[model samples]
Target: MYSRRDERNRHGRDLTFSLLTPEDAFELLAFETAERAWFEQHIEARKEQFYSSHGVSQHIIDCLALNAQGRMSPLLIRHKGVLIGRANLRDIDGENASIGYRLAACACGQGIAQKALKHLMKEARCMYGLETLTAVVSVENQASRRVLEKAGFDAVDKLPDHARVADRRLDCLVYRCVLRQEVECA
Candidate 1:
């Protein structure tokens, strides 16, 4: 779990990050339902069942199982005790992991994404002992690309015709951030 007071918002509420639990199924459902259109614009399409309660419950179960095996960290972002978004560190391979995040449609304009990402990066290094983190964003997603850059990530490469978005193929930009660098000794 990670907690930090954020002063960026007018409410001045502390932001809390925690592992996704079964208890959050309903809140997750609501968040997904509300942000479905907004998210689908930038992310891959979700199954029809994923919008249902049963599917969400199963997702929660799967996330918990992955957490148990230490292969992923599925996190829920909260502000003032309300579920506002999600951030995940997945595909863990010794000191490296892929990072991903999404915010509620209403939560977009603010600096919340950048703040949450910065905090996650810190936790990834200190708590999880991670040395490097990576993210891939669609070339058309300028906002997301900016978020990654503001969070100290550098665009290392671009893959043409990388992914299929809806009916057409789109390019993807790969960004990476090294949290800690090892020093060479004499």
Candidate 2:
């Protein structure tokens, strides 16, 4: 049930975020199809069905179920009324959750990911009542690491052979942000 419209991108376009809904299946499928190759390079492999409309509809339903159970927040990121990305606060455990985000290829290098992440973090604290957020980034993915750092996450550890991507075991850097301090200070 999350929704916000006040955030904006650098280009002065409105940046909106909302909980993923069944109605978003089409746009989600389209975005996934368009960015599949770009995203696959950085993220874990997805099932073949994930790029299809039926798969996306079921995914949305599952996300909504998780949201209803207070286990996850799957948010759709939109810029100027168009889907541009997604931000998720997943695997909620009490006051903590794991954060993940992805931006469309066309939206990369524009600071949109960082901006959207910052907004998502705020929502995670205020709306979701989360106190801490964790993230894991591939060591080879410098851009994503930078985004996490820029969004105020502190690098905490490096795990060897942490992530398996495309038949390769890659190292990963773990990051954590204490949201309670930020919220209290604000």
Candidates' TM-scores?
A: 0.87, 0.88
Q: Residue 148 in model 1: shift from native, Å?
A: 1.1
Please give the range of 10 consecutive residues that has the lowest summed lDDT in model 2.
Answer: 1-10
Which model scores highest in lDDT? 2
Q: Name the lDDT value of residue 165 in candidate 2.
A: 78
Per-residue lDDT of 122-174 in model 1, one digit per residue for the tens? 76786678888999989998988999998789999999988776756889999
lDDT of 2 by residue, 26-100 (tens): 889988988888887888878998878889988998888998999999998888889989999899888999989
**Relative to the unseen true structure, what is the C-alpha lDDT of residue 70 in candidate 2, on a scale of 0 to 100?**
90
At residue 169, candidate 2 shows an lDDT of 91
What TM-score number comes out for model 1? 0.87
Q: Model 2 misses residue 49 by how many Å?
A: 1.9
Worst 10 residues of 1 by lDDT: 3-12
